[model samples]
Target: MFPPTPPIPEELTLVVDGLTYAGLAFGPVDAPPVLALHGWQDNANSFLQLARALPDVRLVALDLSGHGQSSHRSADATYQIWDDLPQLVGVLDALGWAQCAVLGHSRGAIIATLLAATQPERVHTLITLDSMLPRPAKDEDFAKTLRAFLKDRTALLNRSPRQFASEQAFVERRARMGEPPLVSTVLADRALKPCDDGFAHRNDPRHNGASAVRMNEGQCISVLQALAMPVLNIWATPRQGLEDDIARQRALIAENVPNVTSVDIPGHHHWHMEPEPAEQIAAAIRHFLV
Candidate 1:
């Protein structure tokens, strides 16, 4: 059986903090709203395939700060939990939406979970794709990670942007990065745009550096405990684990959050974009929303 085709939506931009962030809004304006957030190094367009598979819901997907068509900050600001709050709220206000259900992938999932926890009344329900509660790093490992991030940060700041000779050259280079077939296709579609100088990725390279923010396990648990809204947790198959730790974390969330459901979608971490996995996620969202 074929899934009903969702109405094709138009793209637009919303300005927040002097930055114009691009986004897509679909379905009827008055329909129950679903805010879809993309992962690190991804843009709003990443949700296109999944959004098209769902029905009778308003789906809004935004390019996060410093990614896609959004404006980048001049200073090296650490992209912290607080940074997302303003933008999320701004988006809702601009759309005249008082509350929304959220669907987030990876880093976007973390932000969505935090928002649902901190401001429960603003969220109807939450869905997190291939993301776990934030975990604290051991002091030694944390320091090592910080040092490595700083070294890369300095290198990125000093480096000049490079231009590809052609779109095919850039796409060929991307193919060598070992992305899953479906994810690579989605990425190839969204990340490249034609310019007079051939095709270039729309996102800023600084987004890679912005991803270094850290939060501890205790803080994550506190947020989970605070969540009063329903949540759907989706995990991808090639598990990232020490089984004991994973079990412990799941138990903690199940106990703390009032209405929590979990699903293991079959695919790698980037499954949200793969055809089968994306359909599964869309179905899950439709079920929860209805």
Candidate 2:
């Protein structure tokens, strides 16, 4: 059994294309809306502390499809990063919002960039944490990657979701799977759910598959070049060889995007989950959004 979650104020639900997307909301409802999005496998809870740190604005952090409590896409649908943009736009439109600021982390940030660049009027400001793009297409062997994607997708469909002895163990299991934080609380916050037999993760396993196709560097550069919004990129220090790549991405954005402000914050990929780093993120957001 899992321990009870401490009370989170303002539970939210967004129904899009007949699917339910669950989230947590904070601050005043009438304030300029800011939609917060979590990364790959991360849920809406990723923004819990960050929302608490920024009470001056309305923040609604949603569990992107197949993560957290959000409904999974149909079996035929792929979980490509670009597929999230229309659903995201639909959510804001359903909320009667013509335009709203977007705050996304890692994979979610890629979606934000896509939205801001392609549909410029729909996004007010763009803020990303830790990553720019997932695997760039330029560096990929598409034939090999597509084959792996098919294999993994088919495998997941036939396999049952993994179960755990207890929710705490499930959280501990997840902590070891990623870039791993020294503390488990952040991942633990949205990592598990009760299942028929035992506790299991909330994310869909199909997400483990390789991308069927990816945005090549040129495509990514074109989008970054078109962005006219005030963009804030709060990046974390990547591990060794990864640092140079992120620096290159940052330089690309700075060169192309008209109004871009970037700052390096401490901690690993999911730094926004911790209080200290969340505060740093909030400060940058406050400065940029203003």
Candidate 3:
């Protein structure tokens, strides 16, 4: 059986610019906070295992816009990798945190990197799990990317939320969508909601559409180079098709970022969610934060 989940996290709501964000807070309220962000299709509970491992460090894990209990962006907006930036800043200001450590997994890791790069003064320590930069696209693919994004967007807009027979079935279906092949029930609970019969997803459908735009390698490099804050990049063994991107970004970070500590650990991309890997990751983070 999996390690027991920590106590039910305290519920929290942060509002900024008329938008409200829902999140879970763990550990002592007085401890210096580490704003935690989850990956694509994941939510605040993504950090549960890690939070349990690091009981002394306060973790405020937010369900980003379009995901979990958070509000979706206005109809005019799109889920670009950078779209969450201003909202995150607003969340920090609302929390009265001028500067604090930040932790992100997958898509969240990309956002944390963007935050550290654009608002260097507000992040003291950066810890990225299994990812650091956005997937880069080539300049020649811009038109194709835009067209494909539009098509996907239109298609998804006309679709209705799909309900599953049971939460377990939904979790199994989700696990089949990617590598590691494991799903946490805690995460499933946060990502799902009861509907007419079984359960419907809580995530915004737009999240499944292709991004209208993406930063190219050169752009990603500039962002990586701009990271002046101390960073702890904890990456798992890359999945089959990710080897190239992983190698490429590691090279870029090794060459450009001066104060980064890169560590390779075992497990798949969501390693931080499992007990043993979470403990290992906690040790690295604890050492880095100290």
Candidate 4:
């Protein structure tokens, strides 16, 4: 049928701001470089399927801070979206890449959007899977949002990691959380760490905390308008269709960005992590890059 699946990628580690970032690097060293950013709660392995689909492009997928084998941030450091910029810059510096394409999924996609808008010169091409930007905040709800965030921050500070009795238990739990078994198994391989009692997730508890703030509508529009490089916005068309707000925002982004190509493929939110959809997405990315 298709080309044989690619082998597991080589592990890579980069130190930035005293934090160790873990990732997987694949494809030829001389091919066009593309940074891959996975969604929230997902590790570098999220791109495994997509990597298997596209053997021509060089891809480096990171676990980002607080996720997978990456070192967690200091106790005082927050997990805000913008807080990742410095680490990203460091990763780029380590790779000696002055400019390259970026591929992001869900939460990672939003971060990529922000990066493309704020540091347009460093990102030559942007490809976002199933997201454009974070949910916009309303002025009227600012106070309430701040209070909730503070409460969440305090509540999760002392929370303990959840453990699973066995490997199957962990995979089943992850499956119940929405991912298919195939996808869950791939993710569980990296997300689960052996403990005294059982295996527990390695992600930082603070990663589950609420964000302190989100950009407002006008601010998001400004970001959309700031994208000067070619952008491929690929979103899944769920059976229920896109949510009104998300659809509206996606439309707004496409309208504001000068060189954006929008493609809606049939699948769910984590479609890029699935076998069939990953093929379709990889094809779209390959064509877009060309």
Tens digits of per-residue lDDT, candidate 1, 111-170, equal: 898878877788989998877565555545667777777876776764534456675666
Stretches of candidate 3 off by over 4 Å are: 1-4, 179-184
**Candidate lDDT (C-alpha), each:** 0.74, 0.79, 0.87, 0.87
Q: Better model by TM-score, 1 or 4?
A: 4
lDDT string for model 3 (51-70, tens) is 88888877999999988999
- RMSD (CA, Å), candidate 3 to true, equals 1.9
The TM-score of candidate 1 is 0.87
Best by TM-score: 4
- Tell me the tens digit of each residue's lDDT in model 2 across 1-290: 11133235588898988778888888788998998888987888788778877878888889899887888888899898898878888898877888889888998998888888887798878888887656457555778878888988998865666777786676567668764553355655556777877777777888878888877778888888878888888888755668677777777887778888888887788888777777888888888877
How many clashing residue pairs, candidate 1? 0
Superposition error at 76 for model 1 (Å): 4.1
Q: List the residue pairs that clash in candidate 1.
A: none
Q: Which stretch of 10 consecutive residues in model 1 shows the poorest summed lDDT? A: 1-10
